[model samples]
Target: MNPDFPILTLLLFLPLVGGVSVVLLWRSPATARVFALLTALAELALGAWLGSAAPAAGPTGYFLYQDLPWIERFGIRYTLGMDGISLVLVLLTAFITVIAMLLSWQEIKERVPLYFALLLATETGILGVFLSLDLFLFYLFWEAMLIPMFFLIGIWGNGRKLYSAVKFFLYTFIGSLLMLVAIIALYLMHGAQTGSYSFALAELVHTQIPYTTGLWLFAAFLLALGVKFPLVPLHSWLPDAYCDAPSAGTVVLAGILAKTAAYALIRFTYPLLPDAARAFTPVIYVCAVVGIVYGAWIAFAQKDMKRLVAYSSVSHMGFIALGIAAWSPVALSGAVLQMVNHGITTGALFVLVGMLSERTGDRESLNYGGLWGKVPVLAFFFLFFNMASAGLPGLNNFVGEFLVLVGTFRVAPGAALGAFLGIVLTLVYTVRLVQDILFGTPSQPMSVSDLSLRESATLASLAVIGVYLGVHPAPVLDLIKVPIALLTKA
Candidate 1:
């Protein structure tokens, strides 16, 4: 860890700084997008550099760490660091932010400046969440992201935007409040035991927690994450939010926001309260399996393209949960890598869906067919991403899901079998989606332009990433192995 250099701090706050500059260009949306893209690209470059500089996997908790005192009285410090897990997520966030900026370039007409600014703000918050090692700091970043996201959905979204925004906000906010309570309780508990106050995660992890207390804290944390993960019954807000939010907003919501829950369970919940995590593992595993099957079944039945993808996210995230429940190095590593895979594959899917909607002026899958005849390039990319999402071999999703199933089978064969069935169910919906949109007889005769150069470039970038990860996922798997090992240690 290099305390001498504040690179992490720059990476964390650079988007916010850029966002303020973008707001100054309120009158010029084109210029705003150019500046925003440059800012996002710069952040991506910085993340790449940081990942390159990261130390090899080892017994140490993290390297490339930064720590500073922010509040003296309460023993809260501005601490940040990254191991293999954090680096991959950081890079994923940076990469996705760039795609999101590109996605909103022409789609967002009203409040253009505000829209780009919110995207940048969301990046800052997500980066802070991934990098912050201080509990207080993490929570601040966690909740700080809501404002921008709320406005993004409410102002720039589709029908029932405001309702979806409020639902999204309330669901997450309620969970965050419970999380706050848990953080404070843990803080006080650590202070009482150590004769000093601190919100440092390193310090808190060492705090001895009673079984009853740990269970309650775990429940609080799990509830908070479950809402964010939108697992099963708590998922009603998710499809509404995804369907109503703009495509760019959907990218962030489905890509990183939900992944945070899986990351949190591995990073904080498991290590901080090992016993509680183990105790509740079976229950959570059941929820994950149910989500897998339920989300797939529901998605298979959806007629709307956007809503179908939204429900598919619920199904994909269920796999992440199943991987976590397995709790083996292979399973955990797969979960971490799957988070990145989901972001890329689904982000591309949403982008393509957005393009289709933009061209046709509708999101209903039933309204269109034989798109391949009109827009071959778009059809090709759509098929490519669909293959990636459906976990075809040699693609990124396959590697993660395969490892997850293999790991789970070793520990819980029944759960693994259920997940496999979910995968099969996913094939049913995803294939049907492709056929309905691209292969069937024309539902409505129409001429549509193919993907523009800019759109092609954007999808091409994501497609390249998907292929590289699919063929050579070793880099990501290698990067995350140490962190998974550290977290799953007895």
Candidate 2:
């Protein structure tokens, strides 16, 4: 709760500042990466303390909030806070950035300095988004990350890297613009009603805008946020970008970036526009259910491993959305916690896929097999993630998915019916991925080795979480329950 020195500000901005300095002070790519990694490590230490010390359970309201008046005349304040949803995300971002640095060790050979710098900068931006309580600060961080991410994909990525980057930037930029307008619209309306201007989410939520106005504001917010969910037709950018980016970039996208939209929906959007959220719950749920089925069906047909993983995210995010839309305590808590699970499980899965691709010099699933016997450790890691993804009974996914299903069934049986189908599809695709990658006949011997010690440490940590949380999810569930309970009141 200490904010005297603005520790969160330092944690969020230092990497970005150091990354920029590396470019100016040390031109060498290796020097850049070393600096970025060093900065990331420092950030991780700070983040670790914050995360571990965060309560095993939280109040139904904000656990930590810091505010300083920025524009007294207009009622704006420089504010930051962490609730149950945010604590996990900020920790995930810092943790994943370190893992991204490790994964980039060999894959990112050229332009290493700029690459890690942008990656670090992107991490800072994401942290800002999660921690910012002021509407203006939130949007600034939201937009700032785009610049680094655009360069990360466009400059250091694959065949359609530029295309993917631009599409990503454009979609999010436009979507976020709409959200910005909504923020302003909400600001002005509330100012008129309350006789003062304010952009604090807490203050704005209490303004009591008419239902009709709330609907439009919600639409604006969702269109901006929803594009990131890349819901169905809007999801065209995710696969290409995922396929084109290097593994490090893709890892951040899957592990952190995409989840931001869903987090916003749960924390900011729903609370601020509850009536609109309630009215649109069924419609949004329909879209989420479609994503569950459609993303899986499309994923089943992908010949490329990266593309398959990308599509699976589309499917997984649908479940995240379903939990949010259901608005039940168990379901929402499950959804919030599942966001962390997805970060660990999916990030590990993609990292493994990238590792195998590096060994084979190809990403096509048909390239080789018989790896299970040859690379048992690698195969073991791969299988663990696959099981987690499948929502296997003893892994993290099962806890979240089960609660979501149980919660949704109580609220809407038809929507739950569609979601149940998604569970089946999840098993289908995950089992196929495991069988094809791990059990296939050996195509050729790999001169490259299995997981490095550092890599193993990273993967093992993620693997342990998947198992530990699965067996005993009470700790995380406790943190998420109060907030979910508070938000779900009729």
Candidate 3:
């Protein structure tokens, strides 16, 4: 632990503190936006510092670890730490939050103060989730993420806002409850075996239990995570919520919240319940392949841009899940990398889509045509990220998706083949989407401006990240390799 500065604590609470201050100060709307942006930038700077401070190339465990007693009676503590994998994720969270805040600058009008406040609070919750080392603390942060997001959607969303918000809440809430039950069960089991009560994740990881008991507990955790990962059949709530939420909310939802499920599988589920994870691998692999094909096929049928991208996410996230099911070191490492890749590509897509909708007041593919001529810069960005999302070479998504496919194929050739088919389907739908919006004949006389300086700045930053990940992802791969190696070896 670095005693010189409590960097983790600062990262965890700064946004929260800034959020409260924003609300209390609550001056002009412009003031709110500037303050939120500054706070978000500060978090980003701190995240960069943490990344720089991390071990460059080693199987180092958690750094800047702070384990302090919180609930002495129950053996819970305010435990926080970050390893290679977590450091990258923390950086992604900070980057996306800053971009999301800036993207919302003009789009969010009503209750601006409250909107930025919620955004900051949500950032805090997500940061906490990525950093917490205690199961109890993790669960607290897990639910903490939901409250502000629920309000963000309910208050600032478009049509069907209230319905979508409630549905999102209900789905995630039910999942969280199941996870809580599993957590309690684990706590009890650990206490019985070790003659001590503790909610620390590291303590729980060493727990010994019967295969039968572990299987049921793993199922409970998987069910909760499945809903969030939103594998086929369980993904019904996502379209409505993603399509209806404000664009800023959609960026966070797709970019960060959805990825949390994949992260949890790596961080907690696999390590703690290795046997059950292996036992369940086949079924999970099937779901992943199915989701990939299903989401791509459904995305081809969508007319609304937001809904289309939402379904595309279902397909893309399947790749992450597939890598996890493979359980190979290569696959797990690829999955971690894909988590960050998806955040950058998908976050960029949402921002671009939001910019278009903000100007034209419509997001239907049918309503747009020859956008390339009207807003060439927007068209260029749209195509760039579209291709990136399609896993084009020399782009971020390609690197992660390729690694995932290669790693999975080594273990599950049949499942990998199915995923490959989904990839082809994805390319088709992506091109169709781009052609419909950017190259087709106009439905009516069109008038829209190119990307503004602020919007261009956001897209450019994401583009740089995409290219960096595609061409030179070693930095990220290095950071995550040891942690992933540990999980795979376990």
Q: Per-candidate RMSD vs. true structure? A: 1.3, 2.0, 1.2
State candidate 1's TM-score: 0.98
Better of 1 and 2 by lDDT: 1
Kindly indicate the candidate among 1 and 3 with the higher lDDT.
3
Clash list (residue pairs), candidate 3: none
Model 2 regions lying over 4 Å from their true place:
1-3, 54-60, 72-74, 442-448
Location of the lowest summed lDDT over 10 successive residues in candidate 2: 53-62
Regions more than 4 Å wrong, model 3: 1-4, 55-60
**Could you tell me how far off, in angstroms, the CA of residue 336 lies in candidate 2 after the best superposition?**
0.6
- The candidates, ranked best first by TM-score, are 3, 1, 2
What tens digits encode model 1's per-residue C-alpha lDDT throughout 110-144?
77877898999999998888888898999999999
Worst 10 residues of 1 by lDDT: 52-61
Better model by lDDT: candidate 2 vs candidate 3: 3
Candidate 2's TM-score reads 0.95
